[model samples]
Target: MPVRHPAPTPPFNIIRMSHIELGVTNLDASRKFYTEILGLIETEQVGNSIYLRGLEERNHHSFVLTKVERPHVIRLGFKVASEADLDSMATYFGTKGMATGWVTQHGQGRSLQMRDPFGMPLEFCYEFAQAERMLQQYGAYRGCHPQRIDHFNCFTPNVQASHDFWALELGFRTTEYTVSEDADPQLWAIWMHRKGNIHDMAFTNGAGPRLHHVALWVPTAMHIIHLCDLMSTTGYLDNMERGPGRHGISNAFFLYVRDPDGHRIEIYTSDYLTVDPDLEPIEWQLRDPQRQTLWGAPAPKSWFEEGSLLAGANVQPPVLQAQPIIAS
Candidate 1:
């Protein structure tokens, strides 16, 4: 048996998930879906790119969409603690033989862009322009009224390898995880965080380098219900893919929807905090069907098999075979 070592202190600091860029086929349709349906406030429009922010956000943007030939994920952005951390990260990743470089395209300063060992495109920055926060503007609330970007869930070929890279090397703490039922347990999925909540990111063993979903936090459980109502009334019932259900892993209330371009977005709330260094992560057995949905509803096959392709990832082969789960 391999000895379990403690997660290492990261050499560089990542503050939180700052933004995400998605490549969309129809700029106008996707913008309307996000702004009119999802309630994200448009912060700026430049050329073929549109920047958006949640109601509680003060940043110029937390989500960006670019006109592209197909729908895909461009990058996952994280804010580093300082400009110095950017320099440190560049050196750290470069020393480890990962591709690293500076990007000046996203209204950021001296940003470091790199592909992690798993080939996920990540951007790190210390500065971005701020915007007016619309948290108190009740009249401006249109749809689900998302507060902020909660977390990103992605698919990887090897959950254990990706989990170690984030939890060990990137200084993220595991809040919850699922393990296989083998006599010797194996990692099946993991939820890790840097911002003291349930997770800033999570990985499940699946197809390589695909985005499972980008989650946005709504203010309350009622907000989730309101969004479902809005979607149904607004003729977007086809977009509602799954749930107004609770998850056993994060204890979050969730509703999954698909954008016009087929990218998945999750409206979520009610996850517990996880900031203490000594806090032990909650683990779930793979055979426990409630680990995914506490309400006894099972996720559809499309939810498991469909995900957005990443723009620059070198796809890898899947390592784990899918298994049957219990459903009520």
Candidate 2:
């Protein structure tokens, strides 16, 4: 099916998306897929977890796929401005009634952990350490050397509520959305940014608060095509969920796949940057295929059906339910 993508918007004040983390059953397998096949350089390995950075990025690591026995998100870490910003975020989350914890020795930097209203673990930190060794190898058999962890798509039962929380509390601005005029929108997907770019994180209405997919940006569209060809040769053609197409909003080329545990991962390239504060968020129709895939193949049922659960320690604050937001 041909999917219709939204018209590309002029670049605004968005900064680049920073990092994403995922919990996996087997660290070795996940590492093989991301490093060996995906071309990301493994910068650090701590216990059962592995930290990978795009070959192009000098900043520590961009993707952290951890080997956890349980199927849930350990946390999604974002880079902040300073230690003071981290402290301020901790206080802000606490006042909002969310439990916040601190991480002092992670590869990228010191981080604070918390949860969204529906229970998806979130972390904010500053000061990622640069990796001393950079990987020199690159090829088609080797995964496309992604440049950085781009954006994250999260699922929530109440899209508007989640959107409001991130926007009003966390300082994320919306870039684009899919909505309806009549009944409550079944799916309200919004592109939100922290530092800038199209978005750092996005929220979609679904089952509960869960991690949907982690995206990695490549240097070019050909790299994405090479990735698709490599996947076909590796007998993992079925893993390609959608795309090798353009996005109407960011004007980037994109391709999505599923990991062994059903976690969604995307390979993308050429999205424009946002650099202004006066930029308005773009809106799209719920039925618009362009909103998801420019060439269009409907997102798989599994894409709509699955998400990462929250970690035990990061449950959301109870007061979130009483906030003046409607549930989907």
Models 1 onward score TM values of: 0.96, 0.83
lDDT of 1 at 218: 94
lDDT by candidate, in order shown: 0.86, 0.69
Q: Write the per-residue lDDT of candidate 2 for residues 216-310, one digit (tens) a residue.
A: 87878998898999988987788887777887657778888877666788888887666577676677776666666665445656666566676
RMSD of each: 1.7, 6.9
lDDT of 2: 0.69
Clashing pairs in 1: none
- Using alpha carbons, what is the TM-score of model 2? 0.83
State the lDDT of candidate 1 residue by residue for 1-328, as single tens digits.
Answer: 1212335787888888888999999999998899999999998899999999999998788999999998899999998899889889888877888888887965667778888787899988988888899999988898899999988999999888888778677888888888878877778788888888988989877887899999999988999999999999998999999898999889999999999999999999999978787888888887687888997677887877789998788777668774537332
Error of 2 at 87 (Å): 1.5
Highest-TM-score candidate: 1
For model 2, what is the error of residue 179's alpha carbon versus the real structure, in angstroms, after optimal superposition? 0.5
